[model samples]
Target: MPADLCPADAALAARLPQGVLRDPAPAYLEEPRGRWLGQAGLIAAPRDTAECAAIIRACAEARVPVVPRGGGTGLVGGQVMSQGPAPLVLSLERMTAIRSIHPDEGVMIAESGVTLHAAREAAARVGRQFPLSLASQGSAQIGGVLATNAGGVNVLRYGNARALCLGIEAVLPSGEVMHDLKRLRKDNTGYDLRDLLIGAEGTLGIITAASLVLAPVPAETGVALLVVDGPEAALTLLSLAQARMAGGVTAFEMIAGQGLRFLAEAFPEMRQPFPAPPDWSVLIEVGLPDGLSAQAALEGLFAAGVEAGLASDGVIAQSGREAAELWALREHIPLANRHVGAIANHDISLPLSEIARFIADAGAMIAAEGDMRINCFGHLGDGNLHYNFFPAPGRTREDYDQYRKPMTRRIHEMVVARGGSFSAEHGVGRLKAADLAEWGDPARLAAMRAIKAALDPVGIMNPGVILA
Candidate 1:
């Protein structure tokens, strides 16, 4: 109930259900990165799909923009609208419900507001797992996960959010509820609207609920950390593991010495297994069938890697606690980076063959130009690296603020030149919309614009997002 709310918006608010309207709060106005503060004429948290549709219909008639919000954990600005007329922020936090789960068919139909952690727990109850694992899963909702097509560590094996989703139910910009949440594995429909909305980042519509795929839990799992000479050796070791594991490789993450140093600097009390962090290492996980020893499998892989000169040393987790500790090191790298404060970060993905080359070239170029510290690491199995730049010792991020933009543009240019993406897992929210426009193909840009104009004639859905 903002004092400046337009008359049409006020009338629309009166027409909605009693509990749907919410008071504006700071959480709904800002994204995680604190890049911008949003303006909302109204906040609507619908408890069900019917209420969600009603709110959208009223907004449609009154021509008020609608910005769909999930868990407010998005790194991009998709959850907020900073400019234009104040919008109605449609939050899906109250719509969390797992409608049904068919373990036999490996599918779970859940409302969009269901947090990823809840879905995973629900699947675990039936001896299955939801493979899309992100550090923010505790707060990231299923709708937003699908909307952004997020990719996490397991993407090396289970694939991205788009692949795990079987179907989705979304409300189009015009307030029409598209009930396409099918459990069928194969549906050769005329046009797959489900695919469009999954990665549209709410520009086309707001996703309400979805049918997600659940994977069977592996009988045995093992984790290991191996020291590699460099990115090239890491890539070679990955190939060796894949050839031997035969689809058993669960995750293959690359870690740089710089990342470990930052962790030590940020969290002095955190236990690090290595006496001194190697220049480069990879933490790999494997899953095997019953009666197969995961530890033995990893031991064999490690021996082979060493013989082939791909890895020099390694450590295999002996128990669940040890495995969790090892994984903790890899997961904490981002937190360490945040604590150190980066001047520039690029979530770029390169062709598998071009990864090592890009890293070497980019690292060298940046090093030759300045005293910036580089921490390049991520899901090397998928060629997506979080290439970040930090100020040198005794310096702050503000000291090199001028280099953030040009450095990001340069890094993205290098990635695109190698036939990779500028925005790998994160959707092209407001942050990278300009990059998308400058680097996107002419034909693809035209098609996207046409789709936007056709689907949202009044353009009330998440304006100032993907498109320029």
Candidate 2:
């Protein structure tokens, strides 16, 4: 590394490959705020692990803040550059290459820039499945998913991104490359350092590559929509369905009647999953092993729900296309709400038993606030819910924006009081840093800060992200 890599230089005439330096004023923003402003700085697109380490080393020596960005699809401002003499953005978008896939070992290694879609496609080509499916998979890079420790709809059984990962390759703040990409199932090491980097949001280190765990592709899938009286009944149906579906229960989501209505209005072609509208409905998916049928499992679960009166109405998808269509309804609700100008959205999780109580209580509280339309629905099987509030019937976006913080604060407090987490899937990026400071346990906060300080002593990598 050289000492001339200062933040002031437009382009430092370096001895490295010309592909590493990028000279352009790219667009940057702090989302959750969605403020897009001009970001003038040099960018680096390192080709390999050594180049990545060199870039970090140069940035650290120069005392320049380095923000590791991947796909820029993160909900929080984790990828944003809001401060510091136009920080250098080290993007891994160019290092996308599937290194190898070992079906027998059930592991695959790929560079950070590889999209989730590409990774899964590679796995599929090899007759394996990378089951971490998220909405942004089309554009989201594997590095971003691993850095944020993202969880998606299928997390009911497959677990989150961290659970699906076996090994990680990251560039430490001191410019040392940690190549811990071993395919071991169990390693009783001194500490789980890979887990530390998993959800650090690029604050600790830059994840350049990862070795991920793969599952056998499901031979068959059964999809169904069950309408129940309310969230409590939804939970009952989930309990019964889980008992029968076991590992096959891939997704167990809850949709409120109002959310379904919005989806219908927004997407006219989408068929409602239920015959009659109920206050709440659950979308359950069962994936069987090779040569096994999920139909039997789904049918038995439905019968039990109907007989017990936990489910009032339901429909089992007759075909694969129908099942995909039903899932589209659930997945596209967020898009529909975005189109309707949703000013505030909370991705939260509560205890399974307390979901009903939280929904009822939160709905009443939000309703009391003048003219707010709430869209509260999501993964009921695991207690995660996307509780969104649109601007009061006819208010401007600005009006809604002003009240977002207060509304979110109250709602988050209620969620905390109910023995639930304020953030379930979406991480504590710049948006929730303050809330984290306030609500996070003091001992835990201190420990996290200690780790952050030790990892990046100069506070360079994604400063002001998850920790102070």
Candidate 3:
């Protein structure tokens, strides 16, 4: 704990509105990974932007750390400040109002507390689609989604959280509310604060509400699971699909055979497409125009892939139920990973050209270190892969604790060398702070530090996060 830092005092409590304060419960202190346990001086759930600003003002005046929390589904330690002076954990649970929905204009203004799932439902109710989809959409809030700039399955077609968001309303570090949630698609304004805070991970400010962009639902959509020879074949097939589809590919995800086996081991009853999982496969989804047939498009893609020796066997979804079933298998992968504990989990991204080499080389490198299982899979179209390491059968993750740091360093080193990011999709929370310090470019690091110092002069916002 810092010497000058203080927890919320009696004065701080009096500053907040009645019913805003709550007990610092265990759920507020824990993250999804169970890697670190946080300590909270207090927990506050403000109902609106004014109350949120008041909470921040009180914390700022008290020189207390303010850790903004949303769904707590974040993999990294951003939501929880494990070691520090106990912070006022600001929860965005009460600000659930969808202020306005402009479906005709293809936009919606929503408070930060609205869950991604709820936002999606609201968009659907108006005959539109909010394209940002995540496995934890039901729990993940819009604030946290933009806070971390989350990337999900549909990033190939629609883009990430940052791209989907048109503007944001946030409470800056000084307790002033930034009410710039404009629904404009084009704004060449000076110093876009919305972008500044979108991926800031609560380091600069707390995002309170946002102007979310909506897209028309695709007229025709189809899904197929294609068996590829390897990552190389998968990349080639992706190129061919793009050339043919002309921006119709909604999501192109690559699944490792090992991931399938892990699913089978963890979920024995779950129905999978293939009789036996191949070494490598891809789950390609296409969304076509009204006149185009999604089934015919996928069928043609499959045939082309087979003729090019990129795919050997596959399964194309016939109905929406079948499509959901196919997607269920992909969505359950993370749950299955948690079922079988992992030694080291990496959410990395690489150049499309380098993914194959990195996968093969990194797999061999990790194998040489110790006995471990690898379940590598993710949004291949976006070059992000959840390359996770697990214990060999009959062993526990505890057995490989010694190799965790060294093996992780090796993997990250290879990724950095190949023009890739060690922390991709998942923000650089407390987990990757050291990596950012060590591997970050000197000039960029200096600018980040300068920005942090200027915006959060008191260092009360998410201390020891990206800067440390």
Candidate 4:
């Protein structure tokens, strides 16, 4: 630890809400590098925007780097307090509150600390859908979701967190709250600052509360499992679903045979969504507008797909429980993957047209690396793939750790070559900061740096993320 950059002093700690800070035990230090902890530091939980703003002000005054945290579900270690003069962990978990739900206006305002699942439930109570549902919704807070601009299964129809958000209330780096909490669908503002902070990964500002746009709960939602030969057929089926179903198609997820096998072996509850496992499967959902027939829309797509040779067989969910079970198979992947072995995970995106080709080529390239199992699956509708390379069947955990950096670089380069992104839904936390510096465009990097410098002149807020 840098002697000059030690833990926060008594004065600073006293300013925080009582019992809101923790200095990790010495034994907890030097355990491992991960999302949760980073050396010994002060972790402060504030109750509201005012408390958060006050914490920021104190940190700014002390030239202390403040890492804003919401649920700490971030994969990239962005929320860890690692550096600077008494780097402080600014947690918003205590401020969780669903402020209001305006069903008529289709807006739900909630504190940043509110869990996504909580927000979704609150919206559902009024017969609306928040539409930013994700695997981590149970623990991922609204602030973290907005900070990462999280995209989930329904992004094909409802868009990502950025699109679902109408306006944000954030504390800028200079300790001033930029409150633009209006629920307006159209605002001809001189500058859309809300957008700036949405995906900034807490580097530019600290999100406090947000006004999120809600959609009326779909009158009917149909889920199905379509077995296809491969990625090409999956793409074809997606095109067919989009064309034949009109605006009803919401989610179109593709899972490879290998990924399915892994899940089946790892998770006992996850059955094969097909009678006979095919090379690939598309988990689709169609959200019918009022007076539209969801079942008819899916049945037509299935018939057309079989006729066109895009799908070999399919199963339409007969009830809500069936639909939820079918979705559970897709949503339980990350958890199931953990039981397999250590894996290098990549959240990447390419053009919809390039997906099939990229999957084919990337799979072959990765195979050449030798002795690794590839569990590749994701939201094919939006061109995002969670391409995870599992450790060799018998390799020790340490062996897998050794390949982390080099393998990640190789895969990222391959993704980049196919006009894909290295980081898709997951934002650049500490894990990707070096990669951003290495592969990111210089001009784009400059703009990000300028914004960081302008908003956080002292670099007190969530530094070493995207810009650093």
Candidate 2 lDDT, tens digit per residue, 1-468?
A: 323455354343253355687655344333433653424256778999999998888778777788888888888778886756677778888899899999988899999999999999999998999999888889889999999999988899888999999999999999899999988999998799999999999999999999999998788988988888778888888877777766678999898877887777688787775654567888888888876678877778888988998976778889999899888888898878876777688989998888888889988997887677888888876789999888665575577666778889999999999888888888887778898999999999999999998989988888888875
For each candidate in turn, give its C-alpha RMSD to the true structure in angstroms.
1.1, 2.7, 2.5, 3.0
- Candidate 1 vs. true structure, TM-score: 0.98
Candidate 3: Cα lDDT at 331: 92
Rank order (by TM-score, best first): 1, 3, 2, 4
Clashing pairs in 2: none
Better of 3 and 4 by lDDT: 3
CA lDDT for candidate 3: 0.92
- Tell me the whole-model lDDT of each prediction, alpha carbons only: 0.92, 0.83, 0.92, 0.82
Q: After superposition, how far is residue 21 of candidate 1 from its true place, in Å?
A: 1.1
Residue ranges of candidate 2 with Cα displaced over 4 Å: 1-7, 11-17, 23-33, 36-40, 273-277
Model 4, span 1-468: residue lDDT tens? 222333356667766656666545442222123434464356677788888888788888878778777776777777665554446777788888888889999999999989999999998999998988788888899999999999999999999999999999999887899989999989997889999999998998899999999998889889998888788889988988898877688999998777777777887666666654567889999998789878888888888999999888888999999999889888877876777755588989999898878778878887887778877899999999998888776775467676777888888998888888999998888778888898898999998888888888988777778765
How much is the lDDT of residue 331 in candidate 2? 89
Candidate 3 local lDDT, 1-468, one digit each (tens): 212224345557777777798765799989998999998877899999999998888888889899999999999899999787878899999999999999999999999899999999999999999999899999999999999999999999999899999999999999999889899989997999899898999999999999999999989999999999999999999999999999999999999988899899999999998899898999999998899999999999999999999999999999999999999989999999999999999999999999999999998998788788999999999999999999999999999989899989999999999999999999999999999999999999999899999999999998988878
The total number of steric clashes, by the backbone 3 Å criterion, in model 2 comes to 0
User: What C-alpha lDDT, on a 0 to 100 scale, does residue 101 get in candidate 2?
Assistant: 95
What's model 2's TM-score? 0.94
Q: Which of the two, 1 or 2, has more TM-score? A: 1
